[model samples]
Target: MLFLPAFLTLLGSVSAVDIWLNFQTTNCRGSGSVLCPGLEPNTCCSVPGRTGNPYTSVTVMHIPSVWNLDCRGHAGNYCGPIRELQTSNGRNTVCLGRGPFGGGGYGFWNGRVAATAESAAEGNCTRPSIVSLGDGTQYDVADLNDDDFNEMILLLTSSFHSFDIVEADGISDDVPEKFNINKLDEASLLPRYY
Candidate 1:
């Protein structure tokens, strides 16, 4: 029985990464943020039910050399189709709400996300190739498995107006940064939906 405890401790020490999702852009400090600490490789790490999909930014830490991160914002309970945010190296404070599907236009994924870290050495996951349509749209195509058929396809629309990319280091949950006044002003100028 004692071996079980030791084994659990050993498993905990083998965790490959840590991920943070925030409701606000540019920072990882907010009431709607969540931290998925000590994530194991090759497994899906989802947002808790209470938090839902209010995430607009993300931060990843301690990425392993053999692992790749895949995060997506879904419009429903299932982790369905959407543009993915993949990174092999650790990232700090990447905004997710500045794109056409995010806050810039449709706001489809402003508050929805599901993430995972998979082992690249396992040969089960392959990065998708993004192709531009040259008509303000693009699509991602990938055959994740070794199968001949393409397994994933995501179409992305582009927005004419661009937003600044927000980056930060070492975010804390205790104190959140003040909301950007310029962004607020820009939001005020946008047409509101009924």
Candidate 2:
């Protein structure tokens, strides 16, 4: 009787192993074809071109936690390259330029690699242009709503403008939660966010 009681008590305490709920049919992906959180796929937003309307391309590289900071100060959390995008009509395709740094701010580029200038120029039609107006000095780009998307804020030597990058098919949804906009300063041999 004691053994039976002990066994019963042990069984009760252990409880029945919860049968793994087979949720294979639960459909984690909502109705949209996009990934979770309702973000469109590869939708890249870009700035207008000076002449023939340059485009943009984007790549995601998980930069090592270290080696993120170098000659360039901490412009963003993860400072890296923005690849230059090729023109749809097959025109001039410049590479993503680099400088002192400023995209969203310190810590914006954390863990992100330089997104190849080629990719940056390709631009996303889905995301809208985030630049508002500017004497074009410095600014911050980020997802104001913190939705893991991106927005641009222009901090020019003369004024400040904020705008959303236009979204494109397969390019719009790749932006980070926020970007440290460091391109508005010093006339250089690089392209401007016109």
Candidate 3:
């Protein structure tokens, strides 16, 4: 949600204090690199304050799989352990390393992967493929919107990389509509991942 502060003045010139309220934020880790650390990955992360502001505006976070306990058949699901990233400017170059030269040593999301499907020969399909939690497939966290909330975009990267958006409510109750990537809009009423 976007918080637009209202101004209360007598003559449109006298203002005492400007209050910034209800800015969406995530408290993810930082990697202190020249790259856009965890700006737009399959998860959410916290971006530290830059040279201009005293508070940060961005963060990183992850969504547990709705299909399984661990991430299976999902590559690039891990958010942390990110080595380097690249972006473009007018004509200059920026690079973030592992040193203290303005490079943050923050960490990103690092999660465990799900176990492989059991072999039929070994025994029965004791571990059921489909569980109560929406068929035990496994989903990764991603940001569908850039508005910046802790909302989770469930990702299923298998033969094809498909995604769904779900507002996790802690326990397995009231699982909302699955997040669809094609339906994402910059100004849509849906929450932003920025």
Candidate 4:
């Protein structure tokens, strides 16, 4: 019927989630853990850190949809389009990847927070707080709904691509010392291809 068109449009608009956060994952992550497009096995063709280091060239983007601008601005040049991930039970999450480079991007970083100074000194952080990277920048250091104990939420201006609600954990340190990356994946949003 004619009404179907209008309804579909309405549904599409409502489902459009704006991603605005970036969580760097370990190497080979951007390619979904399989293989980068047109890339040779073990060869680094990414755009950040060390191209050869698979664990350092990928990012696990977080699209919370709470800010109404989760991931929207830059496209990271080589990153893939954000796509909806599959989830079961009652979990809800979304994600994407930024190929590499330009880690200290624009948007809220460390502007001013009590733990900003401490976070700078400690690097990986150890508490529930926000790090102020000065210059009006601020970053949210919280759980990010993932099981990772040290999740850092970078408020991006916009995300180039987007995915649906899923889970993403594992930064080689998202969990306790007893567990490994594989275990972490069980409790977080795994890279669809990674």
Candidate 5:
């Protein structure tokens, strides 16, 4: 299954709020360096350029995997790690690193590999893979190839202002482990929908 890590940081026009779930992130520890301190477990940093060593600055994130990735006989049925990424100019996209700074990917999709994928055993793979959510929404998934699940999922929305990526908390028989995508706040819709 594809797991959206239990944490997300939203820095928007409104405010900066860091939300955390009990899940662990994978970006730190053993990329040719001693494990950095104060990082969320499994999390590592991402940068647009190499102004400094990666283990020093930048924020790390959990990247989504290429679940159904298929390559020729050279590789198949593997979930590769994303190896590079950075925030887009407008914060609208999380793109793969490139140019004098250097990023992975042989060519370009949208002028850069939107995400990077590599199997420890196999080779490279392309991205922006299509997925249909259980809630009936379709998504275009991209990985930054930064060695984690720090990819982007593009969803068509009526408005950017109303769009939210929500992580629900607590467990109740009244509420399902599987979230209802239609209700970002779950109970916020009761009076109107029920």
Candidate 6:
């Protein structure tokens, strides 16, 4: 009986996720390191003492897996709009931003983030679907996973934003090649907004 309880505890710890938020940019190097640990999947948790503070970078650590993170603004709850969605598999350091493209570009969440929700990825796969969610002025696909697809999709929207996912029989040649930010050069630490 003792062994069973200990084993279960160990198993639970293995599935937990640890995320680090920093006040500095470029590889999360700076003071005020806030660690949000043991994060459960699909659950929103507020970062203690971090609300209303300017956070510039983030680092997520998960044992035996990868996960997705949704940083929310306004309050320490999931009900608020998502400010940013980042993956743990790539870069290790994700630079926070104010908003979508033409907002602040990157390197500044600036007291906008209040809470976070984590979604663990199945296996070691990465999300590849990027869609444009624009009204008419801007056509940028930077938002991640507006619709759940077992993986995160970059969704870019403008004035009127909406999207949907469907199964396709085959790939279309006209479809441009998917872009993966993880594959970018190591020197490029900041995410580009266009």
TM-score of every candidate relative to the true structure: 0.34, 0.18, 0.16, 0.22, 0.17, 0.33
Error of 1 at 109 (Å): 24
26 Cα displacement, candidate 2 (Å): 48
Choose the strongest candidate by TM-score. 1
Residue 29 local lDDT, model 4? 32
When superposed on Cα atoms, how far off is each prediction in RMSD?
A: 17.7, 22.3, 21.1, 17.5, 19.1, 17.4
Which lDDT tens digits does candidate 2 get at residues 1-194?
A: 67854553354233311100000112211110110111122222322221211211121112123312111111221222322222212212112222222111111122332342223323422232222221222222323442322323111111212312221211223333344342234522112221
Residue 194 deviation, candidate 5, in Å? 29
Candidate-wise lDDT, in order: 0.29, 0.22, 0.19, 0.25, 0.21, 0.30
Estimate, for each residue in 1-194, the C-alpha lDDT of model 5 and write its tens digit.
12322222121112211111101112211111111112221122222222312221112222222111111111112222333334222231122212111112211112223232232223222322222222323222222243321222212111223433212111222223332332233221110111
lDDT of 4: 0.25
The deviation in Å at residue 178 for candidate 6 is 54
Question: Model 1, 1-194: lDDT tens per residue?
Answer: 89854654465357534443433344333212233445443323332122233345444445444433344333222122343454433332233442111211011112222322112112222122222121212222221232311211111111112311111211121112321111121211110110
Candidate 4 vs 5: which has more lDDT? 4
User: Number of clashing residue pairs in every model?
Assistant: 1, 72, 24, 43, 21, 4
By summed lDDT, which 10 consecutive residues of candidate 4 come out lowest?
Answer: 34-43
Query: What lDDT score is found at residue 97 in candidate 3?
Result: 24
Report the C-alpha lDDT of model 3 over 69-168, residue by residue, as the tens digit. 1111111112222233322122111222221111111211223111111111112111101111222222222333332212221111111112221112
True-structure lDDT of candidate 1 = 0.29
For model 5, what is the C-alpha lDDT against the true structure?
Answer: 0.21
Which ranking of candidates, highest lDDT first?
A: 6, 1, 4, 2, 5, 3
lDDT of 2 at 191: 20
Model 2 residue 58 lDDT? 20
Q: For candidate 6, report its TM-score.
A: 0.33
